[model samples]
Target: MDAKGSKARNKGVVACERVREEQHRYHEQDPQMQRVLEENYDYMVKHLDPVMSQAIEKVLLYQPDQAADFLAQYFRGTLEVKNYHYVEFQRQQYYDRKVRHLLALAMNSAVKDRPDDVRLYFADFFDARTKFY
Candidate 1:
């Protein structure tokens, strides 16, 4: 950006950061926020049990005797997916146009869908985001 554009953007960033800080402070002190946070935590923990059961059921159905292996694989899988954006952004930080272009293409292929395709589609996003890792 030119000098004037850069200055305006910096101001906007600073304003956003200050507003976020204020929100954190308000959440820390507000009783309503505290109740809402606690309720959210309770809801999340309550829902997790059924999802965990279903995941284990699905895994066990695939390989009944491989529960231990499944858990090990699950841990590694979560680790990789958790770090995907970090690694992807780092790749962006260091790579040139061609590398980013290839990354985008590979990403698209990984999640590609057609109307006549047998795989699942979604409302929130149009692509199937199944991980091969």
Candidate 2:
């Protein structure tokens, strides 16, 4: 990975770890904070763009076992949201970089385990992108 990709991946791992920790703490706390967290999570889920969600779903379904990898990629892709200095260009670059990274990771794993499915997965990703954009 390049410097940027490495940094992005690290950020993603940190974010996931934080989220998990926060969720655990919230569960241990009173019901109020838990309710608030649930509300916020629900709102975020409800507002997600349908096309983007579908694309992610397609990628996840392509290899269910790689869901964690995909989530890591998606998290890395959106990590710029935590940066106060993030600009539109930077956000776009991050998004593209993450998507490509995620795809390549998945493709490589598929090629290693089931080489014949690599082409099918690529075709599925291509078809999904048409709808994603």
Candidate 3:
């Protein structure tokens, strides 16, 4: 083969090797995350309302991080869908922001409240995202 062609092939091989190495590293790191996810799964199953648990389980089984985003979206949509124009306007302009801010604070409190479960929940969430992408 020409020198240029051989060099190009070598570069491709190196890139492939690098990708494989990165994959291996990720696989190695996954076990800890998996452990966390399993713990969170248990907590969710035990503590959450049945419908909420089912919804979260569906997300965990498919796309866990999406559960939180879905919750956020649902809250936003519900606020938007309210028939009261004044309430809806207040929600859209003021209440929603305060609620979201409070939700964030609540989440932070909850994270501290159950560190292990929170860790697992996040781990599972990240794992699901990584798998999806």
Candidate 4:
């Protein structure tokens, strides 16, 4: 990477340090401002730092002709994978809740000495896509 681009990349680190310093200075003087700054810092650390550092490092190393489009595609693919996993997690949670609810209903029926209700629940459970037992 050229010197200018390297310096530009390094500026984020410098600005981050400066923000921390300011945060400390204004810790008691302006609590609300401090909170806002701290939240921004945390967000940058969580969301921006890793992906940005890796993307910048890759771009610098490969020096692609269409750097903007390369970065855009990288971010898009990453976001899609993240979304897919998130959806999968939601579905798993829903399935787990449904299974637990059914199991609870079966237990309740058994406690009430209702064999038919218990049998119905077991039948539904067995027909589910996947079974825990």
lDDT of 4 by residue, 14-127 (tens): 999999999888776797877767875665566445545664554344433333333444444431222211212343454354334443543344344433333343334333
TM-score of each: 0.25, 0.22, 0.44, 0.35
Ranking of predictions according to TM-score = 3, 4, 1, 2
Greater lDDT among 2 and 3 belongs to 2
The local distance difference test score of model 4 is 0.47
Whole-model lDDT per candidate: 0.41, 0.48, 0.47, 0.47
The TM-score measured for candidate 3 stands at 0.44
Candidate 4 regions exceeding 4 Å error are 1-29, 78-133
| Model 3: how far residue 13 lies from native, Å | 0.6
Q: Please give, for residues 14-121, the per-residue lDDT of candidate 2 as tens digits.
A: 999999999898778869877867765554345333334664654433432233334443433431223222223343454464455655554444434443333344
Clashes of 4: 0
> Number of the top candidate by TM-score?
3
Which is the better candidate, 1 or 4, if ranked by lDDT?
4
lDDT for each residue of candidate 3 in 12-65, tens digit (9 for 90 to 100): 999999999999999998999899888766654664334344443433333322
Model 3, position 74, has a per-residue lDDT of: 37
Clashes of each: 0, 0, 1, 0
Q: Enumerate residue pairs that collide in model 2.
A: none
**Model 4 root-mean-square deviation:** 24.9
Ranking by lDDT: 2, 4, 3, 1
Tens digits of per-residue lDDT, candidate 1, 1-133, equal 5999999999999999999999998877899878867865554356433334453443433432223333334424441223222222233343342133333443244234322221211211212123211
Error of 4 at 27 (Å): 9.8
Task: Give candidate 2 misplaced runs (Cα > 4 Å).
Answer: 30-133
Model 2 TM-score? 0.22
- In Å, residue 54's CA in model 3 sits off its true spot by 19
